[model samples]
Target: MDEHTPLLYPSPESPAEDTNAQCTGVSGVYHRIGLRLVGSLIVDSIPVTLSYILQNSTQTVSILVTGRLGPEELSAAAFSMMLAFVTGWCIALGGGSALDTLGSQSFTGGNRPTDLSIHFQRCVILLWLLFIPVAILWAFIEPVLLAIGEPARLCKDVQAIMRILIFGAPGYIAFESLKKYLQCQGIMRASTIVLILVSPINLVLNIFFVHYTPLGMLGCPVALSITYWLCFILLILVTLLSPTHKANATWGGLQLQAAMNLKSCFGFLKLALPGILMVGTEWAAFEIVALAAGKLGELSLAAQSVIMTTDQIIATIPFSFGVVASTRVGNLLGARSAIGARNAAHASALTSVLVGSAIMTAMLAARNDFGYMFSDDEDVVRLVSQVMPLLASFQIADGLANACGGTLRGQGRQHLGAIFNIIAYYVLALPIGITLAFSTRMHLGLKGLWIGKSICFGSVRRLTHMILGQVIGLFTVGTAEYIVVWLGTNWDKEVEKSVVRNAEEAKRRTLLEQHE
Candidate 1:
């Protein structure tokens, strides 16, 4: 080989360019991207998860600190936390999915991408606009709780918590919007850094305000609200300083035409609304199980809470993988690299399955240990131990469903996804599970709940795999291969032709010179 000759790999134009090339089959590049995606998921989830844990943690903490408080305080804290979780999570983060969809398209489109500032502005407008009714809902929360069947004393406590938590809505939404912007820009490390710094601060604030300070229950939301604003500020500060953010025109002045583009803004709402409902319905369904467990009495409720917390932490692993896949697939699709999109989906799905299986095994091995750590009561530990196997059993199927849903959402097929989830979870899975839970007499009251959960999770997994199979067929596999083969063959032929032509010309010149 010539010293100056460069090595060439098989490409679509010259050879078969494997769709797998874009996948994590490559070493350093694959792992680096993987780490970034996983890191983003962990970092992004920390505050939210901590918020989830902290909010829940506050109930017990409140009960502990507020000595002699009756069931009223407990129930109020519960309702407040519930309202906060549903609103903060479902609205703030849910509404921000518009960024995952649009920001992705913009990022990949690069040259002709929509104005980042306009997208940000429009989302902000829509987010704030959506905030009005939810805030109103927060305002009338007492009457609503009263109407729903909550005890009068409990209603008062709930009302106080609602009013305080409600104040955090604007901060929650604003911070979430900023997070989406940073994530879309692939600048999640900054968000992570900020959150790590602020979360402990929030925790300390939660303890001090709830236990010692005059704030009481109100202090929790106040602390959480402060952290949310802190997150937004840090993200904005990072956005201003990052070269990548500036390069993407994320800091561009907002054009009224761009920001007020109702057509485009509504387009985002169209994608986001169903996406929100898809996940929300599933969450609400699970909450129902928890509610049902509450009916089983305090031991059952506490046991379920402890189990659910551990379960949720485990659940985040697959969901996090889904997040990574969604971002990767969305970016690829937005680039119009259909082959790459397909490969990314396949890779992500496979990763979820393997990871899920591994987690399940680990959970099974440590099932008794996990339950024992949460409670010293033999009865609670024994009950939790019985339930662990069921949770462990559901992991694989659950992971597949979660990961596939992410892929579908990234593909701009959220409508189909929403329908599938509705049918799979609500129509089919939940019904079967509820029947097994309530009607079937296995003497497994709480375990029965998990039995239904297992069935529902499994059904969704099967459905997702089938849907993915059909979608995978639409990928540009044959076309990409054809392009690779044709480019290679034709380009080689042209080179051969040119070489021959040059050789003939050189010979002719040599003979003519000899004759002269």
Candidate 2:
């Protein structure tokens, strides 16, 4: 056997002996495990959450600048953001979905997994290449906006923003690739540190470009692009400092063959496709809501932005938990302890609920203050406040779905998650929400959009949580139960085999002694 392979089987042990040490629940022995898991998650989640907030603060600044320019500019910025999201950010999610799986898998595999860095580099190159055609399509953005009945003036502003953003697509993809690399090595905290470092720089750039330069709305995109590349560089530098990256065979060089292996490359694309669509579909649904509101007029569009900004900020909380849970669950699964993976998944899911509930309470209590953080206008505040309840009510479900989805992805079950997302977002949420937001005469208006989102979020949460929980029980706990049962049923047979082997070894030893 290879030195790394363990071929020697252990002596057949009685089930009773094992059961004597098996943890019953979270009472005594399990309690410490639970605390450690939860504590680790919280510790990791904090920096990540702060990074997300700081990163998004640039958008806040952009919106503030746009707000000063009046409604048309604000609408233009919103339109431009949606376009940037679809073409660039959405693709990263797809590529990143693959990264999350492969990265975690490699971490589990040890030194050999380190060689997978070449694969990561190859994937990033492929994504950047793929983005070229998409970038070229930026020229048609104005026509598309016009086709959608967007105001001519707003369409022009959106075009400028799109042009600037498209220029930076390669950098954006690179940044995402680096993030996955760090995340997979169990050194995810590094990316958060880089994000924190880049955020203030981004803010200053945004201010300079908007106020000092002639870029105006275009400066927002310019600033963001610069910050993104900065974030990428920082991650790459920090990651290279890690011992694991040092020990890896795939760290350096432009070995075209190794860097561009098609078979493995295609596999990654396949694994990531569904995740890309799932996130894209959900994001597209929101963009549609914003578009529809824009057609309604500036106030509706502004209101949507306010609600969305808040949602995006708050979303980091659930997202932080999900990322940690995914890593933890992936680690346990890769370790081959199905029971441990199940426990980790369950703990993560429950922790999500607790976190979500806390966020829900906080948001609900602060519903009155939701808009003031952005603007002093009574109309925007009133509209946002009216929609706050719907948004707040769905927080727990949203958090649960995010956490469970991460758990599932960590287990290489992203396809299952993608299906749930399609059914929830497309079949249940979009149609219903759009109708309510546009057609309803209940005087709810944008509030209807919020309600529809809540409904979608709630539906997805219940379905995913229930499905994931059952899966964990069947795969993890059920596997453990089978092992326990088998150990009990065939204890005598195993013991006999062990004895026979031992006797044969003794006979060989005596024969060797006589020959000597």
**lDDT (Cα atoms) of all candidates against the true structure:** 0.59, 0.64
Highest TM-score: which candidate? 2
Encode model 1's per-residue lDDT on 1-516: one tens digit a residue: 211111111111332334344444234324423543334344443443343344334334444443334455556666676666665467665666666666654555433333445566667778778778877777678788789787887777767767676666776677667766655555545555566666667667667776677877666666666666666777678668777666656565655554654556677788777776776666776777777788777777778888787876677666655655556555655555544454455555556566767877888898776777878888888788778877777676666666676666565556655675577567755665556556746445777676655545433334443223321211122123222222332223322332332244334434544776
Model 1 steric clash pairs:
12-484, 13-488
The Cα RMSD in angstroms, rounded to one decimal, for candidate 1 relative to the true structure is 13.4
lDDT of 2 by residue, 374-411 (tens): 88889888878877877777666777777777765665
Query: Lowest summed lDDT over 10 consecutive residues: which window, candidate 2?
Result: 3-12
